[model samples]
Target chain A: MSIFVDGNTTIVLQGATGSEGSFWAQHMIEMGARVVAAVTPGKEGQKLHGVPVFHSVRRAHAQHAAKAAMLFVPPRFARDAVLEALDAGIPRVVTIADGIPLHDQIQIRAAARAEGAQVVGGNTSGVISPGKSMVGMFPYWIERVYRPGSIGVMTRSGSLTNEVTAWVVDAGFGVSTLVGVGGDLVPGSRFAEFLPAFETDPETQAVVIVGELGGTMEEEVAEAIRDGVFTKPVVAFLGGRTAPSGKRMGHAGAIATGSSGTVAGKVKELEGAGALVADRPCRVGELLARVVQ
Target chain B: MRLLEYQGKAVFKEAGIMVPAARVVRASENQALRDEACAAARELMSAAGIGRQAEQDPTGSSGGETAWFAPGVMVKAQVTSGGRGKAGLIVRAESPEDAGQAAVAIVEREPSVRVILLEQMVDSACELYLSISTDAGSARHLILASAVGGVEIETLAEQNPTAIQRVSVDPFMGLQPYQTRGLGYDLGFSGELVKRFAQVTSSLYQVFRANDTELAEINPLFVTQDGSLIAGDSKLIIDDNSLNRQPQFEVTREQYGTDTEYEAALEGIPYVQFDGDISLMCAGAGLTTTVYDLVQFEGGTVANYLEFGGPNYRKARRAMELCLKNRSSVILIVTFGTIARADVMAEGIVGAIAELKPDRPIVTCIRGTNEEAATETLADAGIEPLLDTEEAVRRAVAIAKGEQV
Candidate 1:
């Protein structure tokens, strides 16, 4: 019933011999995600949290039948790793590097489209399907935040996801899945791209979006809602409301260029499209309650 | 990083694109340097066959210097931001001495402008716009051209959308010849003019790809009276992420923001200072901005926005030290760490506080990924962290207002 990953989904860990990669690979395994194989160029046959290791994604995919690839590669190599996963025919890929070049992201998106697959991030924490399984950096053991339920969550921010999703759980609801699309100028996939899956999932009765003021992704989500591509009730909390124009508010993509990509612009568009827009993160849970009801 | 006019022209020249003959006059208090700049301007004018009559021989039959000093030279202030022509930062000078005077006046008017570009003004039959930029919507490099040039492309798009013709270039295949030819024809060029236009467009695309440029723009691509196209102005912005590979672009502190911002940039932390009373630091960009909003929503203005998370999660102490330098009444740190461990961030925060204790009140809402250990670390340091972000922001705002927490 989860959107992207579940307990049955066999995952391959790229860059699995690295420190962050190894740590998260163990964490994913601990959370019941089937980590079948690990990929590191030189360190083949090494085991990561009892998972078999291979040098190439194709070799790992051939042996383990991995459906997904989780990348812990650095920014410079992120594009190649994602492309390798896609080339190996892995249906889902998630990259956790935050500093991938914009051009690299463009190539990654094109490759993902051509392969008919989904790549989650270059700056993301990863995706999590609560209770059933998870393939990201989320601490799923925290019941106060990540209890299994029917609401779907898609975000462009990492830390904000934890805070906002905690509010969702606090509102007497839980999440079916949470996807971090990453906060970059060009994400491998966008918020609207995941909406169709959320809409069709019987467990996902409502969706919560943690968007920011930059790029047209939030506006695209609004367009999707207006076009009836997604029919489920949605609640969104947009960040950077008080950010000044022309100043890059931390994220490379999180800048208001000219008049577009402003918080007011996103708010108006989302609200006009019949999605409940929460001004505060705390209000997300309350709005979700109202929308789902 | 946005390159100065002279720098961009140098890059264009490297790419084999045609540009107007130019000389740079750097503003300085040194008298000798000032005289040299004036001399450089005079030399440029003489080279362009336009100079003072006094500098020429009394007899008209001297050298190859032309008698006509008609179109004159252009004195442009070499600032990164645009609207120089409308802001009176660009001036036309009929003589070399006039060009020097114009440069002096421009530098005087805008004291921050340290460089002036003096170029031979081209006589144009018409102007066209051309650029290669990364388009976020299509996730590709876009080639945009228009016959109607240089009145701000955004304004032109709103008023006359069809005037701007766009073609998305595939990242792998690059900009094709047929695409540029089609663009040239669409802009109403024909015969040899179309060929030349296509060449310039293709060369500009090469410049874009070679420079790791986010935007390579030629506003007012002047079609000279003699049917030659020359780039009147160059706007090249190199991708910040690609700076490691682009060693040619030396990012100076002056090219960007204030001292604090530059310092943060060096440490790979994204920080933007504001004119407010609260110094806000968070774990992620989205969270940092949301904290800014909440602080403002609670009627408190933020003095800065600094995020030290993701790859920068371990640099919490460094981030805290930077935030401590801000001239703010209160400091607010909020993070719901996921990939960034809360305990590690707390240790860094505690370490920073112990090393450089400030008098300002500090409020935090550090949670997620070893929250208990993080809370314990903060408590051991005599800093109690709040659980809710809104409550922490309210407390910080109240503390800034000199009210009870």
Candidate 2:
């Protein structure tokens, strides 16, 4: 009933031999996430922490029938890795690796869109439908606290989500899904894409959206909120209150390129568009605590 | 990264696109800047086929012939950011003397003004947004055209997106003339207009793809004064990830916002320079936010939230000093994370404070995580660890108000 990765979804890990891929593969397995297959070119016939590894996504899928994928490959190889997933007819993919070239990113996004595949992040932390199943590497401490419930969680910063989730868990509400939709500017998925799934999911009654400065993704989501895509109560927080103007926090692509993408402006826009926006992350618990009931 | 106008022009030129007759003269410290301005003026006049007679003073009126040079002379400031026109960076000069004076004033008064783009301001018959980007989840090369042009293109599209017809070319095929022509028709074009739009779109796409562009925006894609299609105001954002393929284009550019830039500071940390601030420290966003949270909860106002990250007290002290430029009522520090160095972190803070003593209450919280045995470290420094972020904040606020923790 949760969004993104759920208990039954068989998953494959791309770039499984890489440091990040290996680290998360181990973490996800430890957190009780189903680690069905690992895909790396030369790591074929080997294993990552006892999970079988294959040379390509197709081979991995051939053996395990994996329906979802998480990419930890480098930017240059992201397109090929994603195309491999798409080629294998895997409908959903979550790419966590950063440093993708912008042109190749557009191509990857386009291919995913044309094929109707849900590509989570080209430079993203990946998604987690808590309690049901987990797909990517979110903090283990936070995961234990967050129970499955009606709240769908989304944040730009992967670490920030864990921090917010810690408070949410302590406050005694479970997360239906907690996703770090990749704070990188050129992400594979937008809030607009995640909305339909959140909208249809029966277990979800509310959403806590955490956004950062840079890009119109927040405004796009604000527009969707205005359009009545979700009828549930939504409490949102836009981080980077003290983030200097014009400097990107990290992920070279996430600079405030346009007028509307700044943090204060986003807060104004979200509140204007009917979102009960928290001024800072500190007030998130206070804001959400009131709304969910 | 904000590219200077000349650098942006260079990026455009590298893609083999036609720009105004111009060259950036680095004369911030030289009088030769005036001569460079004159040379730039002559180039503009020559390009427009307006030949001046020998020995004629460049500023002299050409028989007052209103149809003098192409359209008129444009003197623009070369800056790295967009909206220079809004900043009055670009101006139209009446004569060579005016252009030179403008350049000198701009150069000396503002070091940021490296050069001026002196050229014939051509009239636009129309404008279009001929760009290559990803739209609708597809890597697309789109030729967006409307009869109307200029900065209001977005508004025009929103009001009537249908009026602004698009020609989506495949990533491999790019923007073909036939595909562009189809878009020209959708935008109500026919006859010579169709060929003109198609040609410009095709050229722009070639430039866009070859240059490894993340975005190539020719806002108000010009229909030149000469009845030819050209790019007006090119805005290109190069993707850093692709720079490896085009090593020649590799330029070290990072956005260093003027916010809290104290030479010793790095660009992307949760750092802010506050006038009245505590030597506050915390890890992660949620824990860091507790400074503002617990303070306000206890009838206190925190100056701002600054995260030192991990459990390192060295970073915490630097952050605290940075926040304590004017100093807060008291210094309340909090550290609780998986990688706890509560002892070393507390010592660093105490060490920093001992060297820079001022009249203020210093409430420290070095107690959390792996600091139970580290009590000896705090005790050795004649300091005690506050139990939690709330107690420290409450105590700091109380000390500020002349009360007790």
Highest TM-score: give the candidate number: 1
Cα lDDT, all candidates: 0.84, 0.64
lDDT of 2 at A273: 77
Model 1 alpha-carbon drift over 4 Å, by segment: B30-37, B51-71, B86-88, B91-111, B402-404
lDDT of 2: 0.64
- What is candidate 2's lDDT per residue for B1-405, written digit by digit as tens? 334555555665554455554545554554677777767766666555553322221322211111223434577666555566666767666566666766776666555565566766555556666666555334465556666666545566557666666667777556656777787787676788677666656666766777676666676666654445545566666665676776655343222223343222342345444444454556544345435545655666555446665323456456666556544667676654433355666666667767666466667665433456455666676776665455677678787677655
- State the weakest 10-residue window (summed lDDT) of model 2 chain B: B59-68
DockQ of 2: 0.29
Predicted candidate 2 versus true structure: per-residue lDDT over A117-231, tens digit per residue: 8787755557777655667765444343356677888776644565556556666678888776665556777776688788898888878887766677778778888898866
Shift in Å, residue A228, candidate 2: 6.3
The worst-scoring run of ten residues by lDDT in candidate 1 chain B lies at: B59-68
